[model samples]
Target: MHVSALWRHPIKSHGRESIESVELVAGQTMPWDRAWAVTHEATQPSAKDGDWAPCHNFVIGTRTPGLAGLWARLDEGARRVTLRHEALGELTFCPDDAQDQARFLDWIAPLCPANRSRPTGIVSAGARGMTDSAFPSISIMTTASHQAVAAPLGGVLEPERWRGNIWLDGAAPREENDWIGHEVRIGGAVLRVEEPIERCAHTTANPFTGQRDADTLGTLERSFGHQNFGVYARVIEGGTVRVGDKAGRA
Candidate 1:
């Protein structure tokens, strides 16, 4: 198999950025991936304390499909994030600043879905990211598997719905399932496949349009008899991985 694409979401449940290459660290999430998250006013106390909590505590596409429309760009040097939407234009701010946090809240208020807990503050967890899984993980998916899922739906599904870190090609549909508990090498890095990634309401939203246009989770359940899509892997060796690199069992 070969690596087809790489992605990072600097902020959890927000925009995604495509990259040509990325450095992986042992037992860590992808660099800058889910480094910051917007917590709702009603977020649980444990989540408010900068601890990794469930995805429900934050403003996510699952709860507000409109959020999937936003595109995010993180300027690590400037410590700022710029978010843009076709309808909302753009807003840039430093997530670490109180004033900017308030500005961010205001910027996203109109986009928040009705009756959902509103975003109140931005939170960070330093070098460790606030990933969906309690353990640090890098999500991986294959083009074949994606095609299989889309075939039954009679429509193309965007890979963004899976929110995977690595996208591979040349693997059979759902072949990654057999890879659990095994180590795979991609470019110079080695990762141990841990578990299958379950589908969520988040996948129902279209990343490009930010609308609940597809029933991805439902499709998975009906067709596959299970709500699963991708696989989660933990970095076992630190190295660089680039698009087009070979991937195989380590």
Candidate 2:
């Protein structure tokens, strides 16, 4: 198995950005994966509630294939982000304000191209219940795992389908699953493997084009007992990560 790629989503449930390399540090989370998600203003037991706020909350893959096309960059100061997409021109979202949030959502919605009507304003889901249960501030995966799964499915798997915060190269196939309970050193940082990530419908949704293909799910179930193909991890040390950094089990 080998570490082949890395990625992060600046805005939750929107899209992902692939990187040649990255550093994993403890405590410091990656730019996006869970940085933001949409939620309903009124409390409801079901996630399907239509009263939810827009882009500020999490998005579903069933509606927009383009939502997966999101890409972003963190400024040198690591304080702001520049968002981009094929449909929408480049834009930025700062960590400020109600008005700014509204504009951010409006900008994002058009680019997302979701089938459903989206809200104009974006709101936070609060700190609690804001992310997936397996979400760690940072996560990692192996290229071999991608190959193991993709090889069976016509030799191509979009990185966006997995939605991982970090991608690694130069590791054994499916090696991440074996790293559980171990702290893996990545670039100048270290991350502890928490558990194997469980599969979800989100995996079947293509992040780039926002298209859904049932065959993707069938391929996963047939190739791997479970649809899951990655793991969740937490940073144990802090440091900057860039491409070409060495990754290995600590």
Candidate 3:
């Protein structure tokens, strides 16, 4: 199979960006993917040290679906991000700057659920990234599998709801899910597939509209007997992975 698309989320649960390529490191997340995440008031006590914490500790799309509509552009050299949403307009800031963090919080205020703990600030684990998995992982999803789920739902579901790091074409539905413990190669990188990614409520949100328009979890449960949609794996060898590169069990 070949990689049909590549993407990254510079700030966890905040925004997503499309990319042509990225240099991945062994045992590390895709560069700048989920590089920073915001902690809520309730989670600050345990998450303030910039260490890995459970995803629920953060203000995320699962709780605030409106955040899913965000699109982002990154200036890698300058360490600045430009985030845009139909409701919130746009913001460009370096995540490391205190002032910038405040600006981002202010800009995203309208999207956060008022009932949940307020987002206090941003934290970073540097190269480790704050992925949902305790082990640093990259999520790989197939378009065919996406279609398999969408077919019964009118075939209108957007793949963005999955927020996968790499999207492959030419694989049958659920084909990669069987690759657990297998070594796979794409471009110059080698990776080990670890486990299927059991999805959450976040998948129900529409990326373009930022609304929970579908019952993805329920559909997966009824249709597939599980709420899984993608596979998560760790890079075993560091190298450049680019769009359209051949990838599969190696």
Candidate 4:
């Protein structure tokens, strides 16, 4: 198999940015991926301590599907993020600045579901990204598996909905399921497949339209007998991974 794409989400449940290459470090999520998240006003106090916490402490796509429509670009050197939305235009702000955090809150407030708690501030996860799993991981998906899921849905599903960090081609559908406890070489990095990524309500929403137009979880259960689409792997060897690089069992 070969790596077909690489993507990162600078902010949790906000937006995804495509990159040609990235350096993977052992025991860490992708650089700037979910580095920051918007904390809701009613979030638990433990979440405000700037440490890793469950995704429920922040505004996420599952709760507010409109977040899927937002896009982002991160300027690591400048410590700034520029967010774009069709209705909100573009806004750039430094996540560390208090004022800028409030500005970001204001911009996204309208996008929040009316029934949900509103965003109060942006929270950082420090060196570790705010991933869904408690342990740091990289999400991996295969083109054949995606097509298999799409086949039952009667439509082409967008890879963005899976929000996978690595997309591979030339693998059989569901082949990665058997990769657990085994090392896989992706580009120059080596990773051990840890577990399957269970499908969630977030995948039901369209990344472009933010509408719940697909029953992805249902389709997975009916077609695959399980609610899973991707695998989460922990980096074992650190190196730069580029698009088009070969991927195979290490």
After superposition on all CA atoms, what RMSD does each candidate show versus the true structure?
Answer: 1.2, 4.8, 0.9, 1.0
lDDT of 2 by residue, 195-239 (tens): 877666666655555556535667778877676777877788867
Q: Write the candidate numbers in order of decreasing TM-score.
A: 3, 4, 1, 2
- Residue 166 in candidate 4 has what lDDT? 96
Per-residue lDDT of model 4, residues 127-237, tens digit only? 689999889999999999999988888868887899999999999999999898899999999999999998789898888777888889999999878998899999989
Give the per-residue lDDT of model 1 (tens digit) for 1-250: 9999999888888788888999899988999999998898788888877777888888888788888877789898998889888778899999889999988888888889779888889899666788888799999999998998888778588878888999999999999999999999999999999999987787888887788888888888988899998999999998999999999999
TM-score winner, 2 or 4: 4
List where candidate 1 sits over 4 angstroms from the true fold.
none
In candidate 4, stretches whose alpha carbon ends up further than 4 angstroms from where it belongs are none
For model 3, the superposed segments whose C-alpha errors exceed 4 Å read: none
lDDT of 3 by residue, 124-230 (tens): 86888899999999999999999999988998999989999999999999999888999999889999999999998889998987999998998899999999989
TM-score for all models, in order of appearance: 0.96, 0.75, 0.98, 0.97
1 against 3, candidate with superior TM-score: 3
CA deviation > 4 Å runs, candidate 2: 1-4, 18-25, 31-33, 41-57, 62-64, 76-80, 110-120, 123-130
Q: Which whole-number lDDT from 0 to 100 does residue 199 have in model 4?
A: 74
Q: Candidate 2: TM-score?
A: 0.75
